[model samples]
Target: MPAPAHRLGLGLAAIARPAYITSGRAGELGDDRDVATLRDRSRALLDAAYAAGVRYLDVARSYGRAEEFLAGWLADRPGVTGGEDPVEIGSKWGYRYVGGWRTDADTHEVKDHSLDAFTEQYALSRELLGDHLGTYHVHSATLDTGVLDDGRVHRAMAHLRDRGIRVGISTSGPAQADAVRRALDVRVDGEPLFTSFQSTWNPLEPSVGPALAEAADAGARVIVKEVFANGRLAPGGEDGTEGARAAAALAARTGVPLDRIAVAAALANPWAWRVLLGPVGTDQLASNLAGAELTLPADAAEELTALAEPAEHYWATRSARPWS
Candidate 1:
């Protein structure tokens, strides 16, 4: 029998390029010499995530051939439904991989949300992912980028929707909440264009949750990213801030790992359809899956919820993250 697909609320992310990049031992993921190794590693991660009951996998064009890696892994799986694979794939455009897999590249990626960029990256993503591709989003849509206000882009998105492809936006920056609210308001000829959204929501930067809840209430599928605040809530994380301390206290009280408690907090949100797990290895993935099973006590949850930092401070700290 085929593996049953998980509900929309849980998924995996390939941002770490696990197999292709050597991580931990070196400050960087492995170099080009590690392509085969990285592929194997990513494949193992996918296998584990599926076994752990994750059905949605998020990747982006800027994630260094993540689309290709996902395609290779999905080739062997049968669809949960009759023809479509049980796994739902969500990939984004608007960012290009400029790193060439080199650790020393001055810039690893460059973001462009122009109509031409969408045209090119969409074709590239489609070519690489084929039928396995499910939803496509405009990566990191900001108020300044004006992606939401562009009629041409809306037309393109609406056309994709008409063809049965789900369209949405992934937002970044301090104004992420505002961006989400605007995205929810976008429409082409009376029908809403976006049915999905990927946004950041963690203890330190949860300013977007209410907006996400609004999106969810409006019938959009909401995927939460950065639940661990880019590892800030992990054990002995670099931030050393109050949010991290709260996570540690919760872990001690519950006897769960700090990471697990952090992720569990995000899962507790009813509006989050899927809280993405950015595990870099089998052990991390296992830890995250365990977190998914935890139900935090209401008081503990309230303590964690109160850890939210001002949106500006949170995004500033995020902006300074060393591009891992």
Candidate 2:
């Protein structure tokens, strides 16, 4: 009689340190405090995240102060602090630092995922994410000829795995996630890399539907990020009523809100092994966790599917790039 692995994972996504309440940057996470200063705040957040049952911690090298801050706090802690509350943590590399200053505050940062960059970056991830680093990604790059040709990247990854690290890719698009899955299916030599794939999948795009199913069928673990349509599904602001209904109805049974409705919907995908979430503050975390505690009835699930349809327009245009 054991709890399921998915049940144990917290559906937590460690976004680029919440730099601006946006995906764009990691500087907004918080000003780099002089070690001792930010230390307490970082500890509090991670502590709360742990206590709340968050098992997955997602991060990236390009995420400004995020990885550095995490390395600051987590480097010394052992995995499985409490025996019963087990966890799996993941991080991504492949972006270069080159003196390390804040990138554009508004423009989204980039993911390199090249072998030369990824090799060094993975070293940094090892220092920062500790035992929580379950999966490593070739972060954010679309498929490239370089991915296959980089013997150094492959060798570096093999080195890490020989040291007991699990390696994978952080695909930028639904199509890319599929490509990673395909690669994993045929990987029979050396390290036997990447048992997981982390990608964006939710009600809005639903583009990940087939890829997720395929990944699951391939037995590659699927970790879904952005379950809330990047915050559109939440119940604040002048919008989200229709979105709220499905959640509210589901909440009739679970007592949470649209947040849980979204989580339930993502979980309903069966192909989804875990739903990773990002929260701005403590109150938001409580609400999301509360939602996590409930299950949606069949009717509620269908209603939720219809509710999410409108979410398609929430971010109609990535406007500049990778959006739209």
Candidate 3:
């Protein structure tokens, strides 16, 4: 069966539903794992997201300490879920397991979007995700990655559809939008492929937004990522700052936090069916949810758009560094 449209909107999910670890690798913070301890922390994260009315869970085979943690704590998430119908979990395939642990030691992951690898990995992910599955995507996809074009992604995706799952592509480029459009041309369970997709679409980086609009126009539901610009929207840190004052202004005018407006701007786009979110802590999820109110008074939206765009049109030419 197809996923319900009601699942869109404020119902978007937060990625990597757990705290530590990649799929089987070490956690990002490299915390040593005791299944019991992780189970406790994972439950707390999911519980908070659930209580906040989140209905989607986005995970990847490469999220480090996240997917396996979710699988282990699957049944135990009620403490954090707060009695809601279990969340709609969406995990990705297309990478070698590397022993199913979070590849924590490495700051960046290697890309492997091959067919056989994707097929094999997805099968196992299904076993881990079980019944709560709603969407499955290509993890960390780039335009050059063959995952979308390869027969294997579709084959494995087709297999998942046979099992009654909805499949989509997770992309890092505008070209993936084209791939999604192409993927939708084929028949999988009588429905076109890539019913849903995730991509980075924050205001500071508007390159993918138009592509996403094209996808939505073509019938696929688009889920936006990095609405916070991956921490760049926060009070400036390592990266350069361009939109802080504008971000702060929007926050003050709307009574929404700067962090919330980062997300709210993405949510305000009619083409975006849902926006994927991530919070480091349980309370952070609440702050992220503040964006879900989905209200962007017309002037606020315009100013925020202006804030995101610079005099030169993009921030690269500006004298300032990127916002952390």
Candidate 4:
């Protein structure tokens, strides 16, 4: 396999860290045991993605040294991703890793979407990723967080934009639609500061789709994440649950993997400029690429929308997932 033959407009998430401490399929999949091991795996993953026609890489400051891992991988494989057009590296600030690679840590990440947090994380990201960094996003933007409303943060983002780096925000929680709408209103001297937006849009939580379309119509590129609901759409996950059953039924009817059906549903949204697939290995990545190319039947797509859960309930279940 020389990688997927078609462009999927996909991005890779480098937060496969917790696999270091646990033991199982997921553990093995996320196993970034040490800096050296992580660097090697990161390079392999990135190589696989580029060969497969993926051009975007998404990471975060709190993703347990993801910036460092990506920088090392890029340094080793210069210009290999596609000659004139190289990979685009988009990373997020506003969170810091406190897990210290511990499996028993009470809190693995701490969020702080303040101006000062951006100040520190921005410089740190620059120091680590150097010239490879493209876009910097406010990690997990929520309505109450004020990252989108703060004028000072907007000015700071303006400064970064002046330097030619695209600015954006990643949203989470039940209020994702509200946050995405608010981000669209962010202006730096009467011009929109955000050129990109990433949000969760899976069968479990599809309410944000319209807002994402609004952002796209406003000239911002929309990237869809969590299309599988953080693994809920995969086999061995929520087997007896309604969402799982629905996805499985669709998969069997369409002759696609459950994960593919989940991702394809998200990609079917016209507003999604890029749909991220965070695969733990090359095999999973390949499957995701295939899913990205699928165009689900009109009936199947509409039925998937009916599986949407209340945003509150969906987020509650996601939050309850133990950090692996």
Q: Encode model 2's per-residue lDDT on 201-265: one tens digit a residue.
A: 66555665676687778677787776766555554411334554455455557555777666766
Kindly state the number of residue pairs that clash in model 1. 10
Candidate 1 deviant stretches above 4 angstroms: 1-33, 78-85, 236-238
Ranking by TM-score: 4, 1, 3, 2
In order, the Cα lDDT scores of the candidates are: 0.76, 0.57, 0.59, 0.77
Query: Which candidate would rank higher by lDDT, 2 or 4?
Result: 4
Task: Report RMSD (Å) for each prediction in the order shown.
Answer: 3.2, 5.1, 6.2, 2.7
The 10-residue segment with the lowest total lDDT in model 2: 315-324
Please give the TM-score that candidate 2 achieves against the real structure: 0.75
| Stretches of candidate 3 exceeding 4 Å from the true structure | 1-39, 77-86, 96-107, 174-176, 186-191, 235-238, 252-255, 308-324
* C-alpha lDDT of residue 38 in model 1: 69
Candidate 4 residue pairs in backbone clash: none
Please give me the total number of clashing residue pairs in predicted model 4.
Answer: 0
Give the residue spans of candidate 4 off by over 4 A.
Answer: 1-15, 19-32
Candidate 2 regions with alpha-carbon error over 4 angstroms: 1-41, 75-86, 96-108, 130-132, 144-152, 174-177, 186-192, 237-256, 307-324
The CA root-mean-square deviation of candidate 4, after full C-alpha superposition on the true structure, stands at 2.7
Expressed as tens digits, the lDDT of each residue in 193-217 for candidate 1 is: 9889899898878889899999999
